[model samples]
Target: MADYDLVIRHGLIVDGTGAPARQGALAVSDGRIVAVGAIDGRGETELDAEGHAVAPGFIDVHTHDDAAVIRDPRVDFKIMQGVTTDVVGNCGAGVAPANDAFRAYYAAGMGPILGESDLPWSTTAEYFAAVEAARPACNVAAYVPHGVLRYNAMGGERRPPGDAELQRMREQLDEGMRAGAIGLSTGLVYAPGAFARTDELVALAKVAASYGGIYGSHIRDESARLLEAVGEAISIGEQAGCGVQISHHKAAGAQYFGMTKQSLPLIAEARARGVDVTIDVYPYVASSSSLAAMFRLGRGAAFETAPAIIASVKYNKERYEGKYVREIAAELDLPIGEAIRKVLQDEENTPSVIMFIMDEADVRRVIADDHAMIGSDGLPSEGKPHPRLYGTMAAVLEKYVREEPLLALEEAVRKMTSLPAGKHRIAGRGILREGWQADLVIFDPATVADVATYAEPRQYSRGIDYVIVNGEVAAEHGRQTGARAGKMLRRGVAT
Candidate 1:
């Protein structure tokens, strides 16, 4: 005869702990899970989930929605996917702690992701404040960008930090940690961060480690010398005494199709040697990134030789929105290299392209790893964006779990939820136990599928029924109920 605000009954519960599903009812009150199992309770709102699988809401461990959340607080693309939280500022690009002098550099690195928007927050604390004030639809945790730190410490300088400069960067990293950042992220191939050597990253990692923060890296190379990059990421974690997360873990280029075969062992060995390590991958064979990533992946020659490399946005939308680069070159009677140069040399443009760089076997190899988790690596503001934005979680459930039977539902849920929360140390979420935060999703596993494709990239996933965020039914029956119950989940700060 207990009272509750809401109750979901008769559902198969996948609790995000990699435990087997059990039939039960979950009760919620005051935005926290109050009861589970055979609930001898009643509530104002009751949901009959007889045929659905209920699990703790998904957590996107890697994302660039730092500015997208502020601009589009509804965040349908996320909440609809049952993602109750987003971990942003990955790939070492964030928009915070930027002074008037250094803000431009931060903006450049973040501009493609955030778009051309006025950045009012200059520190991690302010960024948190803005997100809270806007009342985002899902929870958000952040990592301070190493690229921004380097830019602030040395403006536009492609050189390793000297002693004084390194100390300065360390101070800023410490400030961000104190401001509630969960960790520090590095895009080792990007400028500023690219200029940083292992010793330099180790120095910055030490500052984050002192705060019990993790180090997430978009490693230097994922194509030719991927093992070396993986080795370096492991080296940073070992030397700095911080947990390491390899972001968007993938081996690009057909020549390097099975590189993860080598990379995974490095991680396993690192873990064996007491270096905490994990990786994330989206459930797609094709990867999308800036033209620069393609260039660095040694696909520059292919941009001219191949037509499948299509221009997605910014430079020429009229003639190249849905066509391949080679097609554009053919129509214009221009050489492939010259056609690519036209797009790349345009300073005003930040174009993103979708390249068929990964093999399905290679993608499956990475995602099937025990140490691997899920990250959409979705680019909201930039380019046409990847279908993973709307499709990643569903695709994993549909393609990997049910269709292929490559992964169990429990383990997949574990990756999207508890695994990430444990790695990032995000408390009070990722599990559906009593006293935990009430972020849950109800979906029809039988029909769960990703409808979004490369040709039409903005479609939402299928079979997601109800999404509850902090005990509020945010999205019910596949549509947003206009509830903004999300909070800024700080590391040590409790709401």
Candidate 2:
């Protein structure tokens, strides 16, 4: 018998550790790396990787592919970009602990993309069981969504949790952590979760911390109150004694266009103060969200209200379908609020908007910072979804490393792999070393580029020649190899 199942020969390896690249061969056996550098032994299979760069498969730290994975495990959007693993249940939205009532409540917002037959599990663990049974194309990790916890414990009420209700939520969070959730996630800008008091979050996050779980948040504001949101995240992390990650870190709106510069200092100070603070960013200027998100500020309503809001005459008159609030208001000769209301009246008619609120310089600065990791924040269900869903990893390699030259290739790879794996505590992943899981990628750095654009969002990327997940060929020659070798990563212990 051969010493290894496969050997990739003569490749320039990046190794995903932010270290300098070196030429070597890699050996894999029984789903883990057996050796690195020269291997004189023969193998059952050998792939000639001469002139290619072998690196750890990209791990997308933040994604909203809960439904997408079950529906189509191929996940061409991620695979084509060399991503072999993705952490789902982002923004406090996911398909877990799901009931018919909750499903109905979120249907309009999440869309009709999911089938009733698709969801056969409830808790996070059960959901992963379903994924395992289905055999997805890439590895997946999940977080306990605070929105679902609050809803399950408090019945979707828009008020501060009473002592009893708070305890129930804490117990539920504890249960999820025990069931293998890596952390707790909250969308403080979205309802029910948004209605939660800071103390409630602190208490629940404290429970998560006790179980070794992190607290990740979609902050209360992305624009005007960006600093306050960051402060709130810091406060929660400090009080809860847990690590905190700001999901899709960005300062939105023209008003806060250059505010990332101001916010970075606050994050730095918090880190200096010994609070574990980190951030994730998708490489894009435009953000993707439901049509209702554009008009539902301060409104504690379920996603079901979206379609009705879009059908209103005020929305049509304002022409808020595909344009930003400022742009629509300008065209309609109306106040921003009026334009927003009109846009909400015809929710289904109103497509998701691409709000160009972030500054390119701010994006570059965040990605280059050692404290930040890359997250797609990509919602795949939308009609005109943000291209980041398909282009984020490629964009980082092409734009930041090659074109704009903001970060070195090795550093960028680290942000996508090791940094995120370390943050999420995914063991034996994100590194190209012996005894590590054989999740790797091989590509041509000179040719790798994102082909997807805002106008043509679903196009696949170029230059990712091979992707290996769990020692199986997942993508080969830039095409899916119909392999389903992914596994659900559980946080083994609650923290």
Per-residue accuracy of model 2 over 326-441 as CA lDDT, tens digit each: 66656778766666665555555234555565778788878877899999987665344678889999999988888879888899999989999888877788989999999999
Error of 2 at 110 (Å): 2.6
lDDT score, residue 470, model 1? 93
lDDT leader: 1
* Shift in Å, residue 456, candidate 1: 0.9
What TM-score would you give candidate 2 relative to the actual structure?
0.90
In terms of lDDT, the poorest run of 10 residues in model 1 is: 302-311
Candidate 1 accuracy as lDDT = 0.85
Cα lDDT, model 2, residue 462 = 86
Instruction: Report how far off residue 236 is in candidate 1 (Å).
Output: 0.5
